[model samples]
Target: MTLERITLAGGCFWCLEAVYEHVRGVHRVESGYSNGAHPSPNYEQVCSGTTGHAEVVRLDFDPAVVSLRELLEVFFTIHDPTTLNRQGADVGTQYRSAIYWHTEAQRALAAEVIREANEHHGGRVVTELQPETNYHPAEAYHQHYYARHPDQGYCAFVVASKVDKFLASFKRLVK
Candidate 1:
């Protein structure tokens, strides 16, 4: 099986991690900070907005099972790509929408997908497309956060909504 890796920053990492973990093609969904200025920024540092990092999820998936286009469609549905540096109550550069590609093909596809997403979003899709860089895995507590702390306030209210959206919108892709 061929595997492709893509990193995405759309609001909170927990929300992305929570949803992608349930996607069929996804082998692993790692919550992290990406394209940041800091070499090894922690959650607090990234949250402070001084680290120049966006909370992101690095996904390992097989394209044969779930194409990039499908994954991106799910992403657009889960978060408000039109918002700049914010999702719900979360604010700062760390919560911005972005797509960090690992390959040239992925880069090109990301551009096309963003354009389509923009049109559907009233021409205001603010998702950034960039090369993956300066990535640092978040602390252990952040991994599988929704599954581990489903009752936590943020997970119950915010993350759960995104997961529910994914389930409702992409039933066939759900794992």
Candidate 2:
């Protein structure tokens, strides 16, 4: 099956990475840095909140199993799209919400979803939709982080809750 790519940044990459891993159509999810000027920026540079990079996850998925709109729906629910440059206690541009669309169609779908999401939340959705640039895969250690470190406090407390919520609400989309 052919796959399409979508990149997103919402809060910590760990959280996004964890949720998408269980998504049905998603074939691969790689944590990365995107929409930044810094080439090959490391996690420290990104966490410093100066690189203009958002911790993003690039996913390869088959639209047949999961529509792009469905993915965005899951994305909005998993994170507070109304929040600007932060999620929970994580505050910084690195944690900003964004959707890096790979095609014109993806961009349009993202816009439609964002508009509907804003109305649903009764708050402006700050999630940005833009073409992707300057993407660099995160350090290998960051890959499948939640799966590898489920017992870690942040994963257990923050990431797991989002994952559980998505699984419960979007059961049909889970693999």
Give lDDT: candidate 1, residue 66.
98
Q: What is candidate 2's CA lDDT for residue 98? A: 99
Over the stretch 1-110, how does candidate 2's per-residue lDDT look in tens digits? 99999999999999999999999999999999999989889999999988999999999999988999899989999999999999999999999999999999999989
Clashing pairs in 2: none
lDDT for every model? 0.95, 0.95
lDDT of 2 at 122: 91
lDDT of model 1, residue 30: 97
Q: What is residue 11's positional error in candidate 1, in angstroms?
A: 0.6
How do the predictions measure up, each by TM-score? 0.99, 0.98
Give the runs in model 2 whose Cα sits over 4 Å from its true position: none
- Each prediction's total of clashing residue pairs, residues at least 3 apart in sequence or on different chains, is 0, 0
